[model samples]
Target: MSEFRITGKAKLAGVIGHPVTHSLSPVLHNYWLARKEIDGAYVPLSVAPDVFVTAVKGLQASGFRGANVTIPHKEAAFAIADEVDPMARIAGSVNTLVFREDGTIHGSSTDGFGYIANLEADGIDVTALANRGPALLLGAGGAARSIATSLLEKGFQVIFSNRTAERADGLANELDAAWRRHFPKGDAPRLSTVAWDKWEEQLSELALVVNTTSLGMQGGPAPDWTPDLSRASSHLVVSDIVYVPQETLFLKAAKERGLTTSGGLGMLLHQARPGFKAWFGADTEVDEATAAYIRAALNKR
Candidate 1:
């Protein structure tokens, strides 16, 4: 890629987290800036929790386009945003922020968008998957909620499974209530909770099995916790949202079982597309070249 030239008129944006030096957003955005030949810059901002609000205000005052909120700052971003999209409100977090000319910050969560975009990029028709059967989401955290909401919106029956049964139940109930409030008499989205230990039992009836938990992540809570997919149907699609190691254990097991699988890297790339356009006013593609670039960066790490 060519070197990016930042002039006085450069568009400014970044990613914010407490310890953000490890973020690859700079690489991703900078690559796009250089590729698009735009006078823009994307940086990483390490802001402590106590000063999140002050830092965000300072960024808005300094004419920043916006920034991607990461880690512990997502909730803070949502709280401080002057306006938020419905998905951001439902997810209760904001991963992307846009600073408007009126000095107001707009926030939205792109995790779900990214997740579905990645699947589509792989030529896995999400709507078709929904039609095939329900999706079994293997977690109840923020990521799970976002993915579940997306699946539910896509006409997929969403069943959540988490280590803590209460967390799973609560998330199911919460989303169910939200759906009802939004579409009073509309067809209720199928939302249910399953025991984490017994999620494998639902394999035959599921069209997709997603691991939104940190179980199979590289340095996550349980890196070795890949599930047995011996009973998975031939048409089942296994997906995991942990990208550090690229081919996570969960995906590995699915692949070994001769089932289709989607990894987290695609989701990461797809999710950043919206924020890139919002901040730089330029459209970017998450194609093979972009994926290769990100993979090279990951290999170096």
Candidate 2:
């Protein structure tokens, strides 16, 4: 590792969360800074929910370039931003915040972009699935909102399934409205909600399956059951937004069935690109070396 040093005039960026001690964002950004020899510093700040707004304002006042917003702060970040990107508007959240020269804050959601980018990084041609068939989304939380919006925008019909039927239905309705308002008339995507217990019945009709919940993450509950991929389409792709274990049981089952699978690490890496550029005025690339570095670090945890 390059022993990069911090100077008084270094560009500043960070991540804001209620409990940020476990975040790898600082490691990701600092790696790029050291590699490029940029005079910048990226850190993590633990800010309580009540003081999030005040803390953000203070960062802006302190000449900090920008910060990544996580957890409870994404929605609040959107509300405080002077300008919001279209993706952020669609997702109703913001993970990246940019402080401009005029002292105004700009917010954007890179989660959707990161999702797609991660698929592409894994050699999955997501564009080829456009109009191919419906996709199965396995959650209705914030992460699912972004992935659902992205799938619809990419021309795939979405089937939302969540443990709470009402939440799934509500998310489908919200996404439908957002889809209509964002896309052209004929390009509008179709969305439907499936009961949690009935998700398995619809599996055969899907070409892609995405798990956006914490069910498979470390310390989270394991899935009650695994889908039988043998009966599903051979072209089906299984992806999970949980990367802590690197290979969740959901992904391992898919692999065992000779199906394509993608983990969440790429999303974490790809999502950091936009924020880094906004803060340091340089574009960063997520290459194999970077992935190896992160994987090694994750393995050590």
Candidate 1 lDDT over 1-301, as tens digits, reads 4364788889999999989988889999998898898899999999999999999899989889999999888889889998988767767789999999988889999999999999998889898899999999888888998888888888999999999999999999988887887778989979898887898888999899998888877777888887778788999999989997888878887888899999999998988999999999988999999999999998898
lDDT of 2 by residue, 209-294 (tens): 99998877887777443555666677788999888777888889899888889998999899899999989889998998898988
Candidate 2, poorest ten consecutive residues by summed lDDT: 223-232
Give the Å error, residue 153, model 1: 1.3
Candidate 2: how large is its RMSD?
Answer: 1.8
Predictions: Cα RMSD each? 1.6, 1.8
Model 2 ranges off by over 4 Å: 1-4, 183-186, 223-225
| True lDDT of residue 146, candidate 1 | 84
